[model samples]
Target: MRKIIAQLFISLDGVVEAPDQWHFPYFNDEMGVAVDSVLGRADTLILGRRTYDSFAGAWPEREAAGGEDAPFAKILGDARKIVVSRQQLEFTWRNSELIKGDLVEAVTALKKEPGDSAIAMSGSVSVVRQLLAAGLLDQLQLLVHPIAVRKGMRLFDEGDAPIPLKLLSSETFETGVLHLFYAPAEQAGEGTYEDAKAHLPQDER
Candidate 1:
C-alpha cells in the first residue's frame, strides 16, 4: 500500500499560504533550493481543487518557458497524480486522474492501492486538515520557513477530532527552514474498556 505523504511550506506561526509577506522569501536561491529538493522527491502528487488550479495554470507555462528554477516541472509533468476537484474539467497534465468524491474517502482509497513510489500531497492546506482529522496521512514533510508570513493560509488547521502524531525525523536547511517529518502515533496497549476499569480499582470507596 502507498503511504499518503504530505509536503507543505509553513510559517513559524503555521501559515501556509503565499508565504511572501512578512519574511518567507521564495525568490531567494537558498529558499528555492530548499523547495526544489522537496519537489524532487515526489513520484506521485495529490492536490485539492484550489491548489490544483493554481499549479496547473502557472507551472505548465513556467515549464514551457524553460526556466531552470521550475521547481516542479519534471515531476508534475511525468508523475501520476490525483486531483480532488468538482470543477468538471478533464485534466490536461500527463498521467493526471480526476477524483470527484468525498475528500477523505478518495484519499483513503488511494492509500490502499498497490504502489511503491512515495505519494506526495503538495499545498492544499484544507485537504491536509481533512486528512489529518480522518487520521489518513501516514507521513508529513513540513518545510517550516524561518520567516513568519503573519498572514495568509496556515499549514496545520485545528479540527474537533483529536488525533495524535509521533515525530519521526527533523532536518534544518541553510535557509533556516526546518523540515519536520511525522508519522501517526499508534495507540499503546491500553487493552479494552474492562481493562481500563480494572485499573481504576474494584469499587474503591
Candidate 2:
C-alpha cells in the first residue's frame, strides 16, 4: 500500500492561502531540504481542483521558460498528477488524470495501488480535511511559518473535526519555520492539533 502524504505551507495562525504573500522571504536551504525530502519520496502528485488549475496554468510555462528554478518546474511537469473534482475538467496539464466520482473511493483505491509514494500539496485543504475525516490520509507534513496572515484561508478552518496524529519527527529551521511530520495516530479522531503540538519537545517545537 502506498502512503498518501498531504503537505502544506501553513502560517502560525493556521492560514494556508496565498502563501506567496508571506512565504518567500523565509525560503532558505533548510526549507529546500524539507521540500526535497518530500518530493524525493513521491513520484505521483495529487491535487484538488483549484490547485490543479493553478499549477497546470503556471508550471508548464515556467518550465518552458527555463531558469535556475526550472528543475522544480520540470519535476512537476513530468510527474503524474491526479486531480480530484466533482465537475469534469475540460482541459488538463500533461501527464494528468481526473477523478470525478466518489472522492473517497477513488483516493482509497489509489492508495492501495502499487506505485511510488504519492503527495498532495497546497490548495487541497478541503480534500485533505475530508481525507483526514475518512482516515484515508497516511501522513501529514506542515511547514509551519512564523507569522500570522490574520485574514486568509485557514488550514484548520471551522467545522473541521479534530484528527489525532503522532509526531514522527520535527525540526525547526533557522528561519523560524518549523518542519513537522506526522502520521495518523492509532488514537485517530480523538484529539485536536493543540493537543498534538503539546506532545512536542519545547525546544524542537
The estimated TM-scores of all candidates read: 0.77, 0.86
Q: What does each candidate score in C-alpha RMSD? A: 6.7, 5.6
Q: What would you estimate as the lDDT of candidate 1?
A: 0.74
Error of 1 at 170 (Å): 1.1
Q: Which tens-of-lDDT digit does each residue in 101-188 have in candidate 1?
A: 8878787788888877667887888777778778888887777777756777676656565567889988777677787888888655
Say which candidate scores most in TM-score. 2
For residue 36, model 1's alpha carbon misses the true position, in angstroms, by: 4.9
**Candidate 2, residues 1-205: lDDT per residue as tens digits?**
7878888899999999888799999899999877777764567888888888888889888888997777888888787788888887776568888875798998888888887666655558889888888898888999999998898888776674566789999999999999999888766445788888988878954
Q: Candidate 2: which pairs clash?
A: none
Error of 2 at 197 (Å): 20
TM-score of 2: 0.86
Total colliding residue pairs, candidate 2: 0
- lDDT, candidates in the order shown: 0.74, 0.82
